[model samples]
Target: MSMTVNPASVVDEGEFTVRRTIRIDAPLEKVWAAVTQPELISRWFGITRFTGASGAARVGALGTITWPEREPVPVRVEAVDAPHRVSYRWCNPCLGEPVPTEIDEAHSTVFTFTLEPVTDGTQLTVVETGFETTSDPAADLESHRGGWDGELDKLVALLESGS
Candidate 1:
């Protein structure tokens, strides 16, 4: 079955926020697994091709994101509250070949993913900031918008599947 997250469910909005809240038919830990675990992450989002032998997740925990032509984006855990919240910054994040835009001029951006519990399930919010673009604004926005939408959809599917 296809997963769905209604835009109306968005509780708050920020100028820099990408996805406000994604309610999943799963528990906080389940959602967290989908977000953190390398194997589960790959199963859901197709982002992690493989993982280090360390095999653990903790604050300041480092990992790689599998994107071809792009180096594995090293990630450092900024904040962790168990199955509640997970905030991290992507190290040397390749924001898709700087589009000659002001935002692209910036060295990198900060990506934070938060999780909250709701009556239905877990409410997930992913906020990516520091995208201050001038030229090629459309390209930058379009790429991010499409990418997040697709990724969020995948999260829903993965969570619902009980995988």
Candidate 2:
């Protein structure tokens, strides 16, 4: 039995944010690991690598997420709440431009993954905000809206496939 997945939506109530909520047919612990663990995250999302004492996800952890044929985007863990929530601030560089060596506070957005246990599976909601500070707010919002759609779909597939 496959679950219905939802596309991401933009919530612009004076703040530019992209949000998506999906129900994955997997346990909460499995979902949490996919989002918090660097190795697991790299499997579903971009290739993630932390640049500090450890590569684990925790508050203030610095990292980069690289996609094929694209520059590595700098990332910083902003918050972590065990198997519940984890948020990261990442650089959102303009198209064809290289991302900063480190996360640029002035040109970055924060994305949060919030997970909840459900009767048959786990419900995950990703909220990415701070697009108002980007080069093009509308474009970035739409881009990320589509981005979350693809990225989260991979995550659902990875976990639900029993891998």
Candidate 3:
């Protein structure tokens, strides 16, 4: 099934935030697993250290995700509500290998994914904030804006293809 990829909306709120919402032709449970389970996440996003354990993304769970052709970006789980919401803090710009430390306050952002069951599928929304704390807000915001767009598209493709 073909679908229109949603474009990420970049907003400058003192700092900046990139938000995107996409509808997947899948159930909430399936969508949630895709976002929360490391095995599934890696298929569309990046390679993560998470072991796909349930309730493993609680606050303080720290790990690194390395996307293809990109450096390993440090991440720390901030909040999670199974099958519904998951939020994490990670390096924003991801400029180079090793992001100094886990979600540095001065160079990181918090990204949250929310899932809701819809009539024909699940609605997934991703909001990445905290750019105000980064060294270069504008550049990081723009880069992430494009990044989320592509990543989310990969997610939709992964789910729709039933792979």
Specify the highest-TM-score model's number: 2
Better of 1 and 3 by lDDT: 3
Poorly placed runs, candidate 1 (over 4 Å): 8-15, 49-56, 68-71, 91-106, 133-138
Q: Give all TM-scores, in the order shown.
A: 0.72, 0.93, 0.88
Judged by TM-score relative to the true structure, which candidate is superior, 1 or 2? Answer: 2
lDDT pick, better of 1 and 2: 2
46-89 per-residue lDDT for model 1 (tens digits): 45532343443567665666554655555556677777777655
After superposition on all C-alphas, the RMSD of every candidate to the true structure, in Å, is 4.9, 1.6, 2.3
TM for candidate 1 is 0.72
lDDT per model vs. reference: 0.60, 0.86, 0.79
| Model 3 residue 62 distance off true place after TM-score fit, in angstroms | 0.7
lDDT of 2: 0.86
Top of the candidates by lDDT:
2
**Looking at candidate 1, what is the lDDT of residue 127?**
73
- Candidate 3 off by > 4 Å: 13-15, 51-56, 94-98
